[model samples]
Target chain A: MHSIPGRRLIMGLFLIFLLLPIYWLVNMSFKTNAEIVSTMTLWPHTPTLQHYKRIFTDESWYSGYINSLEYVVLNTIISISVALPAAYAFSRYRFLGDKHLFFWLLSNRMAPAAVYALPFFNLYSAIGLFDTPWAVALAHCIFNVPLAVWILEGFVSGVPREIDETAFLDGYSFPRFFIKILVPLIASGIGVAAFFCFMFSWVELLLARTLTSVHAKPIAAIMTRTVSAAGMDWGLLAAAGVLTIIPGALVIWFVRNYIASGFALGRV
Target chain B: MDKTVNQKAWFLVLPVFLVVAFSAVLPLMTVVNYSMQDTFGNNQFFWNGVGWFKELLDPSTDLGGRFLASLGRNLFFSMVILAIEVPLGIVVALSMPRQGWTVAACLVILALPLLIPWNVVGTIWQIFGRPDIGLLGYVLNAIGIDYNYVSNEIDAWVTVIVMDVWHWTSLVALLCYAGLKSIPEAYYQAAQIDGASRWAVFKAIQLPKMNRVLLIAVLLRFMDSFMIYTEPFVVTGGGPGNSTTFVSIELVKIALGQFDLGKAAALSLVYNLIILIVCWIFYTVMTNAGVERKVQAESEPAAKPKSSAALKPATALKPKEGVA
Candidate 1:
């Protein structure tokens, strides 16, 4: 009973520490650049909508966000689609080199993104995919597919073998059976996998920034360029940072109950 | 789970192989090519096998010095990250409420830092830690702590480490929370019946339940932290000197910034091997410690394959642990 108070105190302090920087980001986003630089206040003084306005009105700024979303969504769909069948095979059947194949796929996830930055740029350009969303989407699969399969396989295996056998006995073909029964049964896993894929692709900067120049430039990359071009637009930079967090927040909101389970690899 | 041995299962796995090959294999080959050959401008190259690698691994040369120095920094940083985040994550996971809307709210807020782009994370801390215009900077100044990350090497290192912990500890906490939640209610009841103390209950029940997930949390954190670039790159540009430069940033500087392709390629291969080797060692050690109770069950002949049914809830539950 005495530990309850201590636990609550620890949690409160940690959450406050976690939110302090974010609070500053949000507070600065609403101020004018002059107000932000010239003085420090606990919150925005003489708040203005001008920073958000600039992002929305400028083609470069707005398109940066759109481009990031385009590639992120593309990568998520591709990662999940390929990972599903692979996950099925791993979960329900054994084949030659399956063990080695799984290890190799997972090792790709562990490789540093920076190592691939130069080569991905060269590879994508040679194939005519440079500066395109598909290039980033495909490049991301090197990391995302392994993660998606790892997560999906965990969830799939948690389901008893009886379910798959019973479905087949009921005269269900593999394709129809997989689409109707197996898919719904592991839909939570799919959601979890998609969120992780969206997240890694969304937050990743080294590969995404290196692979695209103009047409597919991400907002994060654009934010970096803003420093040199505009000589530190503090207000606008904070505003862009705020916008970058929205998609992830929205995704997490949609899958709240499943978050812990997903991180657990869906055993529960 | 019972798995049938069907060579045709390769068909299901083929798509993943092709996609991964295109994305992973081709680029890796290019890295290999760059490492073995000397390159000049206008797409010209000459073979110089193992030369870059020799300079990089030997500590006397400038290239070798930077490589060793940054490798030390990277390994040190990974240690610091794991040291702080793992214990902190376990505490946070333990303290989280078992149920209610509060759970959802907490999860969402914890993920916010993780969801933000890595550069934005650096940007936030960059401005946040500025002694003049930033909140953390201004507060520390007001309290009379001479903190300037840009000018002070110690301050720069501190900022990068704190930023990583802030950004990633939630992931560890979330994974541990999942492990904690999956533990059956009976374990707690049995502990109560035996009059076990709080620490005893945790050590005997909760900690073991979390063993598998904790291994995962450790490895993922280690791999990512060793490769950390954007956050520190933005915050200090790896400066106040080379105080915070990691291998990735150094490789980028040589490859992209300085345009020394061969040296960069060599650095990349050696850097990647270090990560993989460390990972393989940790993984081998952990899995050998009886982590895969499920693998033992599955490796038995199919005709008489018998898993521990009562522990079936936890069986083959080690899907991520086949190569753990």
Candidate 2:
């Protein structure tokens, strides 16, 4: 506990810096545009839920959240399922092009979402997958799948080969051993990986926004258009921003340890 | 550690290959196709044949000048971020409490800014920096400092840079903390026994151990910062007279906003090539680091598990699989 005061000071300063914008957004969300512009109070004066009320009651506003959730869930499921077997292979075996294959997968992650935005818009339309959640879900895989594979490969590699040999000796089929034995063993790895897949898919907007229109428009797109269309509804925009953060905050709380430790295990 | 040379393992990777190929390759091929042609509406394209590419690469041309300017801005942004975040991250990671309840608390707080969607981050900051309404803007003005991110170019840049630092420094700090956590206590004990100074211990032990994680942090930050679009877009709209127009922002303007598909495609290919080259550079650097560390192990009998443990868990703690 020596130098406890110093530690407290540094932590205090850092946390305040970290939370200020978030606090302000939340504060602004409770104030009307008039109060927000005219009065500069740390706390909302005449606190109102009108901004949030507008979002909740409006179909365009609320459906944007639903649309975002729809694709993010789909992408997470798709990324994890495909990445599992692929990650398993890279971990356990020396296949042809295995090294090259892994690098290739990761480079796809390095591909800027902007670089592919226009082409994806074209390709999705060509394949008749445009204007739907599937387009964004599938588009997000370009990055999410690579990340999932890398993280899963880490936990997979940590698994001892003797376990596989023992399962075979115990007369378990490959699929049976994999499902009944291997998967149950690395459930944390799956949890960690799924959480990250969900995170990346949820946050992405360039690909998501470009790939979808009204039928599958994301909350982020809705947020941006609101600014341009209705002029800056600072209160409404602030409320939307605050709402978008809740799901992410909840996810972070759930996977705080996994993200901290999982990166240590998975990447470097 | 020796494994079977199974040819059938390709089957396992097939689905991943197909899905990613569908997602990555087909559009990439479209980008390639578009780059080589000129489209003048009505879904008609003529064989421009490197004309757009020529215009894109030559800084003298109108499109090329825009591309070059934005590319320079993006590079500058990446450089500035690396400069600020890398050192700040190390200091923060060092200050972080290594054990007890604080670990979870620190992780959750640090993780908050990162998990926010990019556009929301922009919106949050946009409001936070408003002169009339924003706390930051209001506070700065109250303090008699001139600050207006809306109209001033330098202010816009500073605001964008600060927002990025706030949003991403935690990622670097978190990665560094993980690296610091993996350092075996024996290294410290050995240093203390030798009467090494704190700087000496950090130089010889902590710095080397952090090299790999630092590489990961740097590469990830570099790529992400270079490709930044949405956050800055929402905040400034690349405004104040193209002061904040990054390549991605410029590309979108050309391709989607202006409907200049051919020029956008050409520019996209160039951008992709640059990013690929960066990835290659970092990949090779990391691989060489791995190989050099391996060579050092082979030459020194003192190196533990010299021949193996080079890839997974080189100096990392083995992840607990007993959780299940």
Best by lDDT: 1
C-alpha positional error of residue B191 in candidate 2 after TM-score superposition, expressed in Å: 3.1
TM-score of each: 0.93, 0.93
Choose the strongest candidate by DockQ: 1
TM-score of chain A, model 1? 0.97
Docking class of 1: medium
- Please state the error at residue A198 of candidate 1 in Å: 0.3
Off by over 4 Å in 1: A1-5, A228-230, B282-291, B295-324
Worst-scoring 10-residue span by lDDT in model 1 chain B: B315-324
lDDT of 2 at A203: 86
